[model samples]
Target: MKDIEVNELKERLDNNEEFVFIDVREEYEYEDDNLGAWNIPLAQLPYKLKELESHIDEEIVIHCRTGARSGNAKQFLENKGFKKVRNVLGGIVAYRNLEEEE
Candidate 1:
């Protein structure tokens, strides 16, 4: 699976690049903070696959609190035939840290 760093993702967003961003963390975690991504927790991924079928060929970024869960999500989407799935390295934690640093 491909890995995307927080800085790179921020740059892409700043550039207004089109991509599907999915947050694989729990609802409460996302409620606290997020990257304005679609909330589809890891446990709900399988059942929600259909909702993302049209994005199978699009650039899709998956993230959780940390990279682990999103790594799994990347693999799962790949297995399901997604062509451009990427896991946000260090996930939201790193993203937030980068924001703080900036």
Candidate 2:
């Protein structure tokens, strides 16, 4: 695992950079607030692998409420032969703080 700080993640979004951004938080959590990322809860990730097969070799960024879940997601994808998986450091908490700072 490689990790991306929330600030860098923010920059990527601002620039409209192309990458697979997956929100591993629950639907309810995502419904509350999110980065408009494709929602795939952490527990459901195994079942969603086929849909993500196309992005196996692409850069995949995962984030959760904090960082733990997304860190697990990063490792899970990596173990599944999906390289370039990055966990958002400090996750959405830090991301939200970035907006507060602005």
**24 Cα displacement, candidate 1 (Å):** 0.4
Residue pairs that clash (backbone atoms under 3 angstroms), model 1: none
Q: Against the correct fold, how does model 1 do in TM-score?
A: 0.96
Number of the top candidate by TM-score?
Answer: 2
TM-score of 2: 0.97
Off by over 4 Å in 1: none
Model 1 Cα lDDT, one tens digit per residue, 1-102: 468999999999889899999999999999999889999999999999889998988999999998999999999999999989999999999998998999
Alpha-carbon lDDT, every model: 0.93, 0.94
The lDDT leader among the candidates is 2
Write model 2 residue lDDT over 1-100, tens digit each, in one string. Answer: 5699999999999999999999999999999999989999999999999999999989999999999999999999999999899999999999999999
